[model samples]
Target: MACTQVLLLICLWLSVSDAFTYLRVHNKSEVTVQDHWFTQRLDHFNGADNRVWEQRYFMNDSFAQSDGPVFLMIGGEGAANPGWMTQGTWITYAEKMGALCLLLEHRFYGKSHPTKDMCVANLRYLSSQQALADLAHFQTVMTEKLGLGNRKWVVFGGSYPGCLAAWYRIKYPHLAHAAVASSAPVKAVLNFSEYMDVVQASLSRNHSDCPRMVKLASDTLIELLDYKENYIKITKDLYLCEFLVIRSEMDISFLLDTIAEYIADVVQYNNDNREFEGVKGGNITIQVVCDIMSNESIGSPYDRYTNVIQTIMKSKGEKCIEASYQQFVKDMRDISWESSASAGGRQWMYQTCTEFGYFQSSDSISQPFSGFPLSYHVQQCSDIYGEDFNFPVVTAAIQQTNENYGGLNVQSSRIIFPNGLIDPWHILGINASLSSDLVALPMQDAAHCADMYPARPEEPPVLSSVRRRILELLTEWLQL
Candidate 1:
């Protein structure tokens, strides 16, 4: 799917609490936001190579007091946007606390490219350890450059960056005072089949029949792939831009994975309403998707599935869905920074292949979706980078990551992990408080960083209380 369309689905479904009416709204023209760059080492692990790169960061000091705290929003896999300075509940907290806010774009993402290109050789420098080091160095450099003396720094991030926020406090406890890791997948696994299991659970929570219909649709599509004539029918029904070909298992995986992604995208961001730099949120909720799937007027389960894809494609203004594995490989194979795949796709995939093997596969029988298995993603690592990044290497890397970071057993203080109960990624996040200072706050009816957004009237009461609790924790930590 197109980035904007995916973002639209992501942003539109958010529901929040009613405590953020006091958030200061700054006109874009009023905020004097400027792009700041800091010189950072390209390879923090290698002391021999002295190569440096300019890292991008943005700051908003509109509410800063002389002795106030610092709020650092860590950028994740995607490009960091300056708009976050003015939006999000973090800004609300900053305004209330009179804290200075800063957002650091992750290396190799957005305009903060550490290298000229994203080839396998250059991407070797991209890892979670390197990113954590970037944060430690950034804090030290910025504290001196800005003359910040003994000010408490609170780190905030969602999704992948959320994991980083928790890990940062664990690795460099002296640098940051507190962290808000929202919807963070702290644990790394080779086959994330639980991802789809949660997706089905979320769907069933909305309507029990929805999962049955989704499974039926998937099975029907798989059966159709056996006949050559059904290929043309599937192509026409799904509205593919190219002819559907099932010459290999990879091709079959591509088709099923593409279909599963449409559903997963909705479930992941269902009710998440934060707006991005250039994209606005929509109302494509799980209920909306289930309604489409259950509407027998559309035809069979397979026909309804086709309609789901067509609805998303039409919303994005895409002419046809791309289901060709060769085209996908060709796009990912392009190492140039100018390629469309460079917009976090290739970079994130590399991180998954190396540091985090978070491959969401349908290997489990409990999940509704099927066809794409563990080997499908393992092969992708080999096809995109090289055979060196095979299953054994990737497995070892995940093991090392868990050993280094402590994964679910991460021992960190003054960190609040707020996760949505319905969010698929919550399977790997901390669901209960480990101690008094290290807290796990699970929102009753939330999904994927819903707490990070400004509170809304329709949000569950637990969400309202969670925001208040987060503020309370931050206040207590800063006082210490």
Candidate 2:
């Protein structure tokens, strides 16, 4: 069957959603919202399966004409925030194109979860293939509801969902006229150390000494933690509420994760990019971190990292810093630590372990400070999902995904693959066009989903060009 025409997904906006405080609840508290729900089959491919689920959806028909385009926006790894429905680059373009915009929550995410319990058995239905099926069913029912069965559709998403946009067109072309996949990692990878390599590159671009200082501090910290005597010193320097002996490899991995996460944020969000309007307080850049590290007036490298965490925490206006909070270390030891991360990251963790395997592990190819081994990530899967779902399943899933979807060798057409050159995830994304119809629009100096952010007045020249190209292609697709 032809893939139903979905809206042109601009960007996954993972980083944008991460840092930006676009208040979905408070901003549109009294906007007279028109949220709706539909009954979706739990297993779309099964004829005998009778399980049904109520899926959440939001739509705006004011811009629709009798025979207008259908814009289907998809969410990823988190709840479908109402701000996306109310405003964003996608909605802005929908208005310009006279399209009926619809935002569909991904199954197993947000309020659309099919199962009552988040058990391992329940997450079996959580896959990109299933989510794509939801899009098709929703498009059919929605087109009928709006009396626009004849209208063309385009699919749009960012990051994971962005990969879905490209896959939607490839997997079922008849339903969608075209797709816009921004920052989509179409090729599933196992050892994702390149993500940190890009993090190093991002810091290098900001200032050479930043990454060097980072490596210096990281190696020194790991060495000191090896000795039992330095545990107190490590705790005091990093501002931890308690001292922890390195009982397991996971212990230091957690500490490494905390520090790497902060660096990843700066690079991925370009939090220091003064020209980027979406990221507030351009003070969070790598240069600022380096300045903190280099100052003789400041304390040691451990103290520098503490300041970095404090700066980020202060900007968030939160009283308790996760790095300093006692529970932060406690959760690392918990079985459901993955779930405790913001926006219920457990679902995404399951997806990554089972299908994507984008575990940001450190190898010889990565920075010297990057000591997060492949075993640690594998251990995390065992820690969270138990023993049955082992490394073989993940290996098979990665191989199967590539074989089925064409992976990096996608032969599909009429899809715009926009990736920021600086996005570490781009290592697995479609960086070059496969054909004339399948275009690769690269944001030379942007970060992950940088193009997906709300339109800024001082946009980078490449981003502006890519936006124009996307609008043009979407316009042409609607006409076809």
lDDT, candidate 1, 208-247, per-residue tens: 8999999999999999998988989999988888999777
Indicate the TM-score of model 2. Answer: 0.86
Query: Candidate 1 — which residues are off by over 4 angstroms?
Result: 1-29
Per residue, candidate 2 scores C-alpha lDDT tens digits across 1-480 of 122222122232123223222223333223334546667878888889866777777766556566678888887788776566656677667767877777888887777767654667666888999999989887776666546767888888889989999999988788888898989998887878888888888777766777777777788778887899987777665555466656667777877776677667776766323232333545566567667767656677656766776776566454442443235433432323134542556778888888888888777465635657877787777676778657888888888888888788988788998888877888889888888889998888787776666667654568877878889988876776
Best by the lDDT measure: 1
lDDT of 2: 0.72
Off by over 4 Å in 2: 1-32, 272-283, 318-342
TM-score of each model, paired residue for residue: 0.93, 0.86
| Top of the candidates by TM-score | 1
RMSD to truth, every model: 7.5, 7.7
